[model samples]
Target: MIQIPSKIQKIIGNEKYIIDNVGMSGSSVYVFEDKVLKIQAAGSESENEYLMMKWLQGKLLIPEVLAYEKDDSKSYLLMSRISGAMACDDYYMKAPELLTDLLAKAIHMLWEVDISDCPSIINLDKKLEMARYNVEHDLVDMENVQPDTFGGDGFKNPKELLEWLIENRPEEDLVLSHGDLCLPNIFFMGKDVSGFIDLGKICIADRYQDIALCYRSLSNNFKGIYGRAACEGLDTDKFFEKLDVKPDWKKIRYYILLDELF
Candidate 1:
């Protein structure tokens, strides 16, 4: 229901343009010349995303916000475009071997970032609660609920799964997480990773929260990307071994399902 404003056209000047919904979220993204304009309907989520971007500017590969405005209709975030490569999808299709290594490196790099200075980011407990609420309120798509291999058949029941996750949430390790580190969110140029995008969920949380998601993605995308042999090659017990702490399998399962809904 949202459209680009006439003033936005004047602000960017007359030029050939392309508008694509670049993310899974309900946000409007407009690409003009060398800039990307992101606007979200008025809400706390939109405001948090804008704040995250403002906090991360120049610190990471995130695009720089040029201007922000809020009127009766919505809030807008204008940023300089990041030019280079497509997301990790092409690599997953053609060169699958690059998938695991690229993801491993990306996750490692994400862990390296210190988010202690960031303000206004949500905590993991709140995020997990939100996920549970979504399930209880029937806001989540039940048809999309797939059984988690790691949790065995116990993952079949959504309520039981949610309860288990809430009861067994992992201790917070307080590392900067991409929050949603799926393959589609990572950009790559050939075999090299360019950067990450869709950073609205960046936060400090248990390291395994991100690790578990990355592990699930790699396992799903490329069978045995971290199998026994691959684990030896990577010099760890695959993804779980690399984790500084063990993840709550139930929480991991719950989060993965929540990701599909998001």
Candidate 2:
């Protein structure tokens, strides 16, 4: 059974809240009618999230931090909920043209953010360092990784993959990036982006950092990796088309493989 943290319980105080168990990892999230509570292990990213969300107050359609508290072990953040369904929800997924168009808009919107005073820097070196730490700590979930990333036909192990990433780093495009632009992290309301969630990794970094993950997410969602078949008219190539760029297969592959370490 899931346990609601005492801090969160006190904050909601006699109000009803629902614990979301699906797809949760390393953190616990509770949803009230008007607000959301996220509890996570106190870590560098936790601190990053608090500051980033607070900093992004009027810059974007994102959650507004109402309260935050950090103790020795856990950190809790309470924020307003963006009203909408997930972009990857069946209703949206079945409408590929709309989904693709909105995703394109989101990509462009992220690029438009002024990075002059961006608080976090998720450059390649920093990400590589994080990959190394996760590798060293055995924090990577190998089972959840791409099927071809391990076993007989793929890279032997995380160490080997890390070495490859180091040797083949791509040139940075330095833009404000979501760091993880997967569909579920995005919310949509009537063909417009409502907000972005999971801001811990938002930073100034290569644009492809967001692109690669987002593309993979699109493909996976269409391919039924999320447990449903591709909705009609789902065209994976439309992502790049909507973004107004040709696909850079090598860069995409590199970024996706690099994500395996985390």
TM-scores, all candidates, are 0.75, 0.94
Q: Which one is best on TM-score?
A: 2
Cα error of candidate 2 at position 18, Å: 1.3
Top candidate when judged by lDDT against the true structure: 2
List the pairs of residues colliding in candidate 1.
none
Global lDDT of model 1: 0.64
lDDT of 2 by residue, 11-128 (tens): 7887787887644466888889999888899988889889988888899878999889877888989999988988899988888999999999988889888989988898999999
Clashes in model 2: which pairs?
none
The CA lDDT of each predicted structure is 0.64, 0.86
